[model samples]
Target chain A: MTRSVPVRVHRDLARAITAIENGYASFGDTLATLPARENGKASFVVGVTGPPGAGKSTLVDRLIEKFRAGGETVAVIAVDPSSPFTHGAVLGDRVRMQRHSGDTGVFIRSMASRESGGGLAPTTHDATALAAHAGFDVILVETVGVGQVELEIVAVADVVAVVTVPALGDSVQTIKAGLTEIADLFVVNMADRPGASRTALDLKHMVRESGRDVAVLQTIASEGTGIDDVMVALTAARASESSNAGRAVRFEVVRNIRDAAVRRALAVLDAPRGRSVLERLRAGELTRLEAREELLVYALAEVINAD
Target chain B: MPIKVLVAKPGLDGHDRGAKIVARALRDAGMEVVYTGLHQTPEMIVTAAVQEDVDVIGVSILSGAHMTVFPRIMKLLEERGVDDICVIGGGVIQENDVPKLKVLGVREIFDADATTQNLIDGIERVVAEFGRARKRTGAATPAS
Candidate 1:
């Protein structure tokens, strides 16, 4: 690990970081070079997901403001849809979160979808690590949790808060749909609306039916209402499950082991013969099962030769 | 090895699934991605870029900070003598701002609707262009 990398490497690194910053898919060698921060040093990973126009972004802004007010630094990762055709991310979702426009304590990243799929994105994990290393106390992840995507924040966050509003459309035919049980806390924002109380009542009824121990709270992020209680409930949840954060310590260990194995395999298998085998697989001369078996044998033989 | 790229989030724009997916896509495409995490000031992104010596710098921003932040990166790299680096940006950029970004030395500007293939193509195109320039000018191609 040299302090001064070659200038071309610098150029490549710059282009890669700029790619992610601008919502494009960056190279993976770029991600691998991100030095891993020490384990168990993770911040409080909290997720906020809800329907479109449910004021999820506003609520996230409120939470981040509060945390920073308490002298806590915050990191926010907002995930938006990518252009399937162009494979780039048009991350307009981050515009709604202008409340913390200039605050130094808040680090917001708008992720554009272009390259990959499924779960909280890997760059999000890297951002979490970077924030932890920078000594942020909390990381707030907000996803476009609409359209049947079951909780992208759940895997990434220690606590997941599902934001829901009253009259979430299509209630005429069905009762249970959208961000329901996956929410650790059910927030009924826009509490200023007329049916707000009724919506809370209905939500309570639904929660009772679902048999999940979710805390339901009321909030009007526009007017700054009931956020304290939401925080209290969230703090209570974290206080109850300090062990979940502890699990990240174990997660990092597994990641390290996987990395070691992959590197070992790559180092041994980087030969002319090994590459020809891959070409055979790509050409469909070998089935994937056969290819895997062959690679295992090849990898072991290569390792022995290198030794 | 596929070309290495680093994606960074500077200022305050907390939205990352797209960056992660792109990183994964590049990985699947046989390239390596090093994500610098979020809240990167221009200095951190540039420092990491120089240290990692990546083939590309992919910056993702949606916070309207692009106008102020992206240019700052260009300036920083210029000061650090790494202006040959290919810079690209994608996110909720206005249709009008594309030219300004290019004028600022950003090689490509993809909007929110771009697919992974477009990004991979952009990286290759930009990298190849730089490779040609390096060859013509007798500058070294980036060493692995």
Candidate 2:
């Protein structure tokens, strides 16, 4: 049996990681609880996303070197919604991170997002914390293909980078509309390809039309070009977040603690009264409104008991 | 409580279709699934399995890294003293790896294209056996 532990201790970190992975955090708002020891660990979560063949894995490879050279531990989470189709990525992320395998400071994980919205909820989020809890200073999540659900990553990250290739056709409505806003920085990869410059220019025009302050970068990825500038954009964003001083992260942390407590109360709980009402509903002994009342009482009791 | 599972991606393999599908079907079946996101090492996974206290540890691997990663996880679990937990697998595993895996004590192997129903039924059955084994050891006994 696994005994519970304090969430801030190193040994207990695994237990906390498990709690998050298991959907214990999902039934309520427990996702925001600050560790008992805030001083213990922290990481910059950077999300990089774009369509397939945009050289995200390769960009990540170069980024690792830039971070490691400064003596920072880097954790990479690459989400792939298409497994067999991604054909080479299972090997690519690994091969790219291989040089650091011996360094002990780099941990890279690739996930197939097959379930609804890419099934990234439990896996990628838990993995990020596992890295932060393991003491990494930087974590990168390379989103699987952009989908309706990939938007969930925004909840877990501090900075969002939307990666795209040169000459994306006008047919991509979602990319042009949905992605352009959330992106703090944009990278036009495969810069050597024809029409790459034109695509960047067109994207810039499209973005400018929207009147947003997004940084656009161009990269030839294979030769390790233009990544440093991307890093500069990322760092600037993080620095701004900390200095903004609204303390939104603090509020989130507090909210999560309360939510976790409520959820735990919901579990290990017995609503004999609610069950009896439900049983009445099943037996047609009570109207739906009556059942609703019983449920409301149960929900209130849960919050009270949780405290 | 429904059977709880921890589906983990260990190593560098990025393919997760099977893992995600299994997670969804299991959740739909009323199972509680705790997914340990990708790039898990044997150490991280064992630590997760123990903490989640799942009835089974189902790892979906296609990276050819399974031969090395799986055994490492098995050994890590044994060391952690949760060897009683059932281990099952899927993905493009070679037929030859099956026998060795069974020797390592995996209960069942589901090949590709196995229906979602197949995985669900297999997990339910394994969970039942797991409960029985726990009872035999007097680790936990049900009200019935």
Candidate 3:
């Protein structure tokens, strides 16, 4: 069992997160040393994802309030997209949650989704783990505004709430196949607007046909209406002892191994021997397949030598 | 790693046109800018800066509250024991108040005449300086 020294200082936690984000040399060791939950229950990671302007941030802010009122510390990681051209981002999600800034019980960090396609920053998982290790009872992860197929939240959160709005022009937009599969619950925010009931009913029908026990709840998040139901549903989903935690761990391990191997392969291809193979291929002395095989052999040799 | 900046609008000023422009310029210059929308108190700004672990904070004040805002933000950062994150100011201000604000640890202040490129260049300089100082002092490293 790793010794648990909860990082209580805001500045220290912030620094650790920054280190992790920057991929510092010692960050892997730091993550390894973080204490796991003693009770064997997974940390409560709530992932709120939705289309842009669906009131995800407002809902998260309300959820933070609910969690804080129950004497639970919460850490929110809000993600925004980085401009592909400039590789920069304007993270504005914290605007809605600024009310909780003065509260020591709440910590909010905004991240830019840099070179990641799954609606999250690459370091989101590590940051969530750090926040959990730091003794926050609830870790809320808000993904960048996503379209269908940005279902990476499934690998991080114990409970995934997909928030949407009414009159998105077509009810079919709500039932996108990729998003429906990952949702533990669906929230129709701006429920006070017209067609709220229609959207909720469409989601309910879809959920019924899918035969998953996903709850569809409606909320006017700005007014805090129906948020209690969301809280209740989230609590119930968490308490049901789902396999999400184990699945997330397995997914992370597999992803890490794949990423490391890819990095090693790239390193091998960048070395002198591999460069020679590439030069030969360019000169038509070797075929593309032959060059690929040679590179793979070099990568394997590098890996074996390291061992 | 990209530089992370917090573009905060402090005080009761609802006119955030300038703040938004600055934020856009910073983003275009390849900086990750966190925008805290209108009416942020010093406590809120400091809290956000500490939590985000930003390289610098650019506070935009049009309410003529620089004297009140800059000192409180500086003091809050000091109170929180965060010295490495540089604090900067921009927006409307009397020319005389700029020196006084700088005396309170506001690193640089831009008035109406300063262009976005000037602001970006100024921030890059300050961030580079702070990064060097943190490297020398190891102030940004987490304690084991």
Residue-by-residue lDDT tens digits, candidate 3, A1-307: 1122232366777777877787663556555444444555445999999899999999999999888887777889999999999998999999999888878878899999997778889888888888787667789999999998887888889889999998875657656678777888999999999999998998899899878899999999999999999999998987898857776777678667666667788998788897899899999999999998888888878778887
Number of colliding residue pairs in each model: 73, 3, 0
**iRMSD, per candidate, in listed order:** 11.4, 11.3, 3.1
> Number of the top candidate by DockQ?
3
Poorest lDDT segment (10 consecutive residues) of candidate 1 chain B: B135-144
By TM-score, the candidates rank as: 3, 2, 1
- Best-to-worst order by lDDT is 3, 1, 2
**lDDT (C-alpha, whole model) for all candidates:** 0.66, 0.64, 0.85
Residue clash pairs of candidate 3: none
Clashes of 1: 73
Candidate 1 per-residue lDDT, tens place, B99-144, comes to 9999999989889899999988888889888733453243222223
Q: Model 2, A76-178: lDDT tens per residue?
A: 7776543333211121244444455444456565544433253243356666766575566788888865733345556557877778886677525424455
Q: Of the native A-B interface contacts, what share survives in model 3?
A: 0.70
lDDT of 1 by residue, A65-179 (tens): 6777677667677765554554433344444554454454555665543343433454555555444544456878877546554444555678878787776653321246544
Q: Grade the docking of candidate 1.
A: incorrect
Cα miss at B79, model 3 (Å)? 0.7
